[model samples]
Target: MRDDMDKVIVERPRRGGSWQGDGRAWRNSKEAGSHLGMKRGYHRTKWLNENLAPLKRWLHKQVHRPWDKVYAELCSGIDRRSTVQAHIFEHIDDFVERGAVMRDGQVWVSASWWGRGGRAPLEEASHVELFVHPLTGILLPNRRLREARAAQRTRHGTWAERRGDKPCAVYHVIDENTQWHRVDGCWFEVTLAKFPERVDAAKREEKRYDVLRRCMVTHGGAGRRPAPDMPTHASLYGRNDVYAANKRQLGRREVRARLGDDA
Candidate 1:
């Protein structure tokens, strides 16, 4: 009963609403009207022709029960949802919410003729199979399961992966805030506070340098005058607050030269 393990989800075969309705309709066709045993106006013959008769033969072989007997039992509520009731329906929701069913002795699901008892994980699925508590039925964690869950909850990806590589345009800032972040190829809703911590401070410096290089190109090379409307190298650096505390690192002369002010 280690706390580290998570219970695997139980998956039942999918059966849509039409299947449920058809099965219920088939059952109603057998009821009689009057004195609770008399024939009702069920249009029994038309119902047989349109619905039950079409599948009667196939169901006979599938369930290995004579069609008449099965139909009688269905009318008596022996099978509530289909030609054969699916075994998983009885406990699927319970098992799903509770997360685990007892293994070996107390397992409630059983295979039905029409479908499997439960789904099996595909060959490529990454899963952890671990022991359960004999009395309380709690899952016991292995080393792999614990580590995998830990990484999944705590480790996020780089900033470039979380957001796009380029800076979002100022015009799109409102729309951008509503957008989601991507981590490990899955999109997740992230808060503004958590967003800033995805990358280290060094990565932010690198991004500023890259944007400055792009601005240099747009300025038409170092020491050349930019048009009045175009953003200058000085503007890009100042707006990004690049190295504000340590401006002396690059020296005033080199900064002016790079900004094209030396010309």
Candidate 2:
């Protein structure tokens, strides 16, 4: 939130008056750009919360296509945010070079692209959680929820970063930002209510097994069925009867030369 005035190479022209009228200040494009970029991020986050907060509860209904609703709302919100960030991102290097914004050493964003792209480059900040949920799919006890919420962070990558790098926590560090982004291969941001579940200890160990073991284990649902530790892993009980009846219609098939005669 602090401006890197110390890093501002050229003295900001003294404010003879309010922005437009000030001759000494706000005189040129670069200085003006820096100011706009820093401020726009705030406007964008406020707008998103006002408009999209309702979808959080609406998305949880267990129904035929509730996920589709969640996806649609998220796409709209994230895209709006990204659009704003892209606008502010245009002038970040001026600030960054001077230390207005701080970043990690492993930079996923390039200063040149971010600096020059103007308002066109901001990708939606999707599934952005104002409220915290487990990065893992399971709903934790309230005590655990407080802990998870405290540690929650936002990041830039498309998929949930299960590795715990806390990727992209800076995407909105200053209320606004710009970067390349997408969800389901389309450009947008998604504020997730829940973080994707982490691999359980057994599943982590299972990855080392051969393909044959994987097939056998899945085919049998056999290892001491792990506890219902995650909401995502909870059994899908409702739709099985409906889907099973129609399997022939959805099942794979092959063609043969004149079925009876060929056989």
Candidate lDDT (C-alpha), each: 0.30, 0.26
Candidate no. 1 TM-score: 0.19
Best-matching candidate per TM-score:
1
Pairs with steric clashes in candidate 1: 32-38, 32-40, 33-38, 33-39, 33-40, 223-260
Note each model's CA RMSD in angstroms.
23.3, 23.9
Q: Which digits, one per residue and each the tens of the lDDT, describe model 2 over residues 1-263?
A: 11321223222343322333233344354544544543432222322112221223333332233333433443443333545423333332222221112234221222242334322111121112121122222211122322232233333333445555343321111112212122222222212112223366455322222121112122123333333221111222111111011111111122112122221
Worst 10 residues of 1 by lDDT: 1-10
Off by over 4 Å in 1: 1-86, 89-132, 135-146, 149-180, 194-263
Score every model by TM-score. 0.19, 0.17
Model 2 residue 139 lDDT? 18
The local distance difference test score of model 2 is: 0.26
lDDT of 1 by residue, 16-44 (tens): 32222223444455563324422223233
